[model samples]
Target: MPLSSTQPPTSTMELASPMQVLPSELLIEIFVFCTYNDAFFPLTLGSVCKLWRETVEFSPRIWQRISMADEGSIIRSRFLARTWASKSKPLPFDVDINAECADMILPLLAPLLPSISRWRHFTLTGEREEERTLLVSEEPATPCTDLVINFADYDSDDDETEGRATFTRQYPTSDRYTMTVWVHEIPASTILMPLDFTNLTIFECVFTGQHTHPLAVIDFLSVCPQLEAFYFWGWTHEDASLTTAPPTVHLPNLKTMTLKSTCMTRSLLTSIHAPSLTQLYLAHLNVDFQLPPYYSEDGDSEDEANDPSQSPSSDHATGMGLRTFLSRSRPALRVLEMDFSDMRTKDFRFVFSRLDVLEEFLIVASDMSDKVINLLKPYESCDSPVRVRLPNLKKLALYNCQRLSGDAIVEAVSARAEYTDANASSKLQTVSQVEVVDCEGFTSRHGQTLAKTLGNRLRLH
Candidate 1:
């Protein structure tokens, strides 16, 4: 974009100013700072001054981020995309494009097609199948490190609606390039194979409805051998009618995984082996809290849910699958967080015992019982000879654990805080901080008692 001759010329006094004497490198850095907080830097910094505009043009890093919001015109978006693509040469750029303008803007991104190989990260938000197809169709032979796709018109503020989930692919108005075709299931084929999932290290897929199948996910995972982080939100579940299990897909490099859907948890946890996994977060929006049957410390149990022969759809299947996964992976887990889940006490014991190095544990809105306290109870005082379950645990938080008694909470914290060896040395399992929030059976007196015992180490809310 060249400066127009009609534009005002610099004043003679301003030309002699100290600001005009700054080096080109310093000026380019200043332009970067002007737009460092924004993803659309090229659009704003190109019009500053003749020298500054040239500096921005010469610096590829300054023009490497491209973001298109919903409020831009098609012509403007196309112009900005072309300008940035031309200036950010030989460097991989992070691209974020909202799907709302796909009809008008996507086709005009032809100038950027040849440079797609330099894309480091691609985020497509609220895209329909056709727009996604268009993106892949134009993509060059490049291997992106991160990819995020939202298959739904997702409103993060909206609560989960009732009924079977569904994906609704929307397009522009009929006068525009509208797509009339609709399918009951997501075109999973477009996701992995088209964009080449083999190179992706971090991937996230979110959908509106229960359209994705477990087999589709398995297929996706099979291709992503280098994936280190995988996150899925919304209806990624297996059809209960599908009794046959898919072959287990191994992700040897995967380290962080978050599954926020119940069905997805049940589907993926049982199917994937991630030997390098260390961080896991699981949440289920619709889990019924049924107390698990009692089992001796040795884990002998007769409950149907506890039986390994039970079907995958059983109330405890997800938890059981998680336990099996942790056992198989044997990851040096340092952080574990579970929320809004139905995992029972026995499942907790099974999972916790395997994580010998877990240093941070956060459990919220789960069907926790007194057994949870018993597990967290300092190992030195236990009747059994097993080492402390979480000897390395430094932080513990329990929120909305209604079944756990206040007395049990007190005892758990006291054990963690006061536990010491015969030589009066502090045990490694000593919890430095404890936070309890929104749980029943705790009063101000209980808070005062804990505060007095643990001092400021305890937080009661």
Candidate 2:
């Protein structure tokens, strides 16, 4: 076989690629992403060719991450790791090795002991309790010098820790350390994760498991009394029953919170007392919205989703999750946004009954009716139950709310914006900004009617 006949002309081949034209920097980055999963990536990259071997040897960032998968030959793996790590030179490298593999990987790496203090990430698995840390300073941490630690995947139960990241930091001149733990995939641990939650101010976690439920995340909040912001994500739709569901987290200083994933909002709202919350965002949740970390694409959750009590009227629905949360928290919430949460007609009406201090309200892709719109129309009469609904609402956005009617919109906006009385005027201010996007019932007739009253305040998209 002649070489000329076997290969295509140079012009016909793809240009500026790995073989001959890419810059070394770009090539090294591409290599890092491509080979990060391979345990013995460095050795494999070096064996490819002279150029790659040189590139692998010279690029310290490429050498920074060393993952040693110990098969049968401990000696060979150790020697290869040693040679590969040497290329990192003075750069602090991240290392992952199994202590079960003879447990001698560390001993073999002893030659580099002088640089131990400089190691950025060091993971010794098997018998070793998985912990990766960074010592920040001699002094303690304060609110001014806040230290943020994203402790992802604290449990190696599923062997997903390859992507797990952990780092530590400290500050000087303070007496206490305010810690923040951001967990992904819901790592297993006690309610506190064995850390002091006294100073925890921000709590965020993402999950997809059955070992523990979102109930645990809700329970964890009880300790973080000083939290300012809380973010909970993912789907875990098993029957949520905690071993001891006694404590309800009281976040006195909490200002913002986002509850996403199916059934998550419902689960957490049952046990939270944030009297100072200002903003809240709920996405992909419904009455029985139990996703495994807790969202289901179909929005049809079994067992818990069909409960009538979950969507009862405000006064009668004290046991309702959202109602309970809103009642207990008494959030002077400035912003309330819900997306794909399947909020029922009664549910949102129930929600609005307590949010008299709410300013900005946005509900997207919900199946609400004209009846729900009545909540926006506040009457002067203290006798009216709807009078207390959204008195301070400033901005309203209803997008993809298919079930709402144009008549309802016009009536609601008119009542709130046009309601001017000499005696006992109730609303702090009418809805200044309104955005109604991709709604079926909002026809041009509806627009004309609204534009007459709300010259520029109304927006139809």
Cα deviation in Å at residue 234, candidate 2? 1.7
Candidate 1 on 1-461: residue-level lDDT in tens? Answer: 77678866567325565657988778767777766578676656668777667777789889877776546455576678777877777666766656543332233333354455565555554433122222221334443344433332234313431221111212332111111212233334322232223222212234434255657667657756778887766543344213445468888888888877546565577678998888888766334333232222222343333322212233365565676577667888888887765565677777777787787889876556676678776564456653567767878888887777888888877765666222132435566788989888777777888887778888877
* TM-score of every prediction relative to native: 0.56, 0.56
Q: Report the Cα lDDT for candidate 2.
A: 0.58
lDDT tens digits by residue: candidate 2, 218-326: 5556545556777655553545433333357667777877766534455567578888888888776544322233222122233232333233221121224566677
State the weakest 10-residue window (summed lDDT) of model 1: 173-182
